[model samples]
Target: MKTKFFSLLVACLIVTSVFSQANLNDYKYVIVPTKYDFLKESNQYQLNALTQFLFNKYGFETLMEGDEYPEDLVRNRCLALRSNVTKDAGLFKTKLLITLKGCNDQVVFTSQLGESREKEYNKAYTEAIRNAFKSFEAVNYKYEPKAKDVMVATENTEVKNEVAKEIKKLKEEIQALKEEKKAEVIEVEETVVEVVKKAPVVKVQTKEVKNTKEKVDMKASTSVLYAQEIENGFQLVDSSPKVIYKIKKTSMKDVFLVISKNGTLSKKGSDWILEYYENDVLKQEVLNIKF
Candidate 1:
C-alpha cells in the first residue's frame, strides 16, 4: 500500500513540474521591438538584434515591429508573443530578464535573472542577456499554438466582425463607383474618339516624354531601402532592420547598383567594393559582405 502511495505522489509531482514550466511552443511567434523600454534609441548597443537572434536560434519565428504581419498574425494579432528585456539596476552588477507577454499584456514566462559585473555598459548588458537566455536553451521549442484560450478567441472574433463589416461597406462603395464610371465612359466615348484622331501625332510625342520622366522619378525613389524583400530590388538595413540603402541588380553578373542614388556597390574579383558621392566628391570603400 505504501509503495502504491509513493508511486502516485511521484506521478503527481511530475505533472505539476511540467505544467509549471511554461512551454514556449504554445506561442506561434515572438515579436521583438526595435528598442527596449530602458533604451532611448532603436537597437542601441545592438541589444535588440541580439534578442532577435537568440529567439530565432531557439526555433521561434521572429518579426520586427515595423515588419509586415504574416497572414496568420494579421488575421489574429493575439497569435504571437511580444518579447521584452527588462533591466534591474544594482550598485555593482548589471542584471536583466527576458520576458514573453501575450497580446493582452500578460507576462507568460520570464527568464531567470542574469547578472554581470563588467564595467562597460555594452559588455555588461550583452553578457547579462546571454546568461538570461540560458534558461530558454534548455527547452525544446515546437510550435503548438494555444487555440482554446477563451479570452484571445473572443477578442479575435470581435475584430473579425468589425473587419467583415468594413470590407462589405468597401465592396458596396466600389460597385457604385464602377457603375458611375461606366455611365461616364458612355457619355465621353464619342468625344474621346474625335480627340484621339485629331491629336494622334502630338499625343505620341507627349507620351514618350512622360515615360522618360517617369522612369527617372522611379529610379530616384528606389534609393530608400528596407530589409524586407521587395519584388524587383534588395535592401540593406541596420541591426534594427531599418533600411539604410536600396540596391537594384544590373545586367552585369553579380553586380548591383543604387537606383538613381549617389552610391554603387559591386563585387570585384573576390572582394565587394562600394563607391558613392560624398561631400561633392567620389569616395570608395572595400566591403566585407557575407553572401
Candidate 2:
C-alpha cells in the first residue's frame, strides 16, 4: 500500500510540473490571440478561423486559455480587463492574444487580435497579422522583425505652404461654425409690405428661397463634421520588420515603426536589410525601401 501511494504521488508531481512549464508559443511568426477572445466575442469568426488555420499549419495547439489576469489592468483592456493598465491599452490587449510553442519550450509566435479603434476592424487586421508573421522565414527559428528606413524628405516649399494654408482654412471653418452656433440669433421674420402687393410677395418669396438654400447647406456641414470625427480613415503601412529592427538596433542609424499582422506597433533600428520569401524560401534582399 505504501509503495503504490508513493508511485501515485510521484506521477501527480510530474503531471503538475508539465502543466506549469507549458510552452507559450503558437508558431514561428504569428504571436496569436488566446481562445477566450473568440469565445467571448460572438462575431469575428472569420478572424478566429484564419488564426486557427495559420497556427494549425505549423502544428500549434491551443493551450489552456482563460482570463489572463494581467499584472495591472494592462492599460488597453482596462474596461474589458477592468484595471488602469496602460493609456495605449489598445496597443496590446483589446485584441486577442494567442500563443504557440514548439521544440521543447521555444516560443514560435504570439499574435494580437482586433482593430485599434472602435471601427469594425475588417479582415485586413487578421491578414496584416498573418503576413507580418509569415515574413519570418528562418526554419531554425529566429523571429527578429526588421524596419525599413524613413524616406528622406524632399524640399518643396510650395507644396508645404499650400498644405499648411488648406489645413488652416479647414480649422478656421470649423471654428467659425462653432462660434456662429454660439452667438447667432435665429430670427424668423414676418412682414406685411403695404406697397404694391405683388412686389412685396415677390420679395417674400426671394427671402424664403434663400432660407431654404441655407438649411440645405447646414445639413451638409453637419454630415461633413461627422465624417471627419468618426471615420478618420487613415492609411497605414506594414512596419513589423521596422519595429523589430529598431528594437534590435544593430548598427541602426535611423528608426522605423512597423505594424505587425496583429495590429501592434514595433520599432526597428538601422542594420536591417529587407528579406523576401515565397513559402519559406528567401528570394532576395534588396537593401532599399522602395525596392
Candidate 3:
C-alpha cells in the first residue's frame, strides 16, 4: 500500500507540471526589449538578440521593442509576454536567469539560474544565457491567445457601445446638415424665379418697307438675330454665344452696319459680302444672312 501511494503521488505531480507548461504555451508572442534596466547599453553583449533568437527557436514569435509588431499584439499588448534578463554576479562566476511577464508586470515564467566560470564578460554572459535557456527547451510553445477575464471583456463591450453611439450621433448630425443645405438651395432657387417673373420686358418692332428706287423689298426680322446689348450698339450671335457679327449704329435712323476684324459687310443685290484689306490687297467674302 505504501508503494502504491508513493506512485500515485508521483503521477499527480507529473500531471501538474505538465499542466503548468501547457498553460505557458498559450501565449502567442514574446516581446524582448532592446535594453534591460540593468544593462548599460541597448543590446549590450548581444544578450537581447540572443534572448529573442531563443524565444523564436522555442516556437514563440518574438519581437524587439523597436521591431514592427503584429496588429493583434499592437492592439492588445497583453497578448504577448515581455522577456526580461537579469544578471547575478559572483566572485568567480556569472549567473543569469530569464523571466517572462504579462502586461500586468506579473512574472509568468522564470528559468532556472545558469552559471558560467568564464572570466571574460562577453563569453561568460553568453554561456550563462545559453545555459539558462535549457529550461525553456523542455516546454513546447504554440501561439494561443490568452482569454480575457470576464470583467475586462465587459469593460471592452461597454467601450465599443459608447463608440457606436457616438458614430451614430455624428451620422445624424451630418444628415441634418445636408437637409438644411438642400432647403437653402431650394429657397434660393425660388427667390431667383420670383425675381425673373417680376423683371421688365423690352419690345422690338419689325417693319417691311419697299425701296422702289433700289428695286428691292427689304424686310426686318428679329427671329434669326440673337442680340446682346453692348455699350455701342449690340453683338449678334447664333445658337451659341460666339459673336458672328458686331453691329454698330450709323447716322441713318434704325440702321446698323457690321464691323469685324476680318472685314466689313455691305449689301449687294440682297446678298451681303465682306470686304477687308489683307496683305495690302482687298479681299471679299460673300456673307449668308437671314435679315
TM-scores, in order shown? 0.46, 0.21, 0.50
Candidates by TM-score, descending order: 3, 1, 2
Q: 1-291 in candidate 3: lDDT tens per residue? A: 999999999999677667657767767788899997777999998989998998888888898887888756676787788888888768998999899898888887888898999998899988998899988766766665445644555777799999999999999999999999999977866764464334221110011112222212233433354668786566777766577778654443443445674334456677555454444344445555544
Clashing pairs in 3: none
Error of 2 at 243 (Å): 99
Predictions in order: lDDT = 0.73, 0.34, 0.71
What TM-score would candidate 3 get against the native? 0.50
Better of 2 and 3 by TM-score: 3
Best-matching candidate per lDDT? 1
Relative to the true structure, candidate 2 reaches a TM of 0.21
Q: What is the lDDT of residue 228 in candidate 1?
A: 49
lDDT comparing candidate 1 with the true structure:
0.73
Better-scoring candidate (lDDT), 1 or 3 = 1
Task: Report how far off residue 164 is in candidate 1 (Å).
Answer: 21
Backbone clash pairs in model 2 (N, Cα, C under 3 Å; residues 3+ apart or in different chains), count? 41
Q: RMSD in angstroms, all models?
A: 26.7, 36.9, 13.8
Prediction 1 TM-score vs. true? 0.46
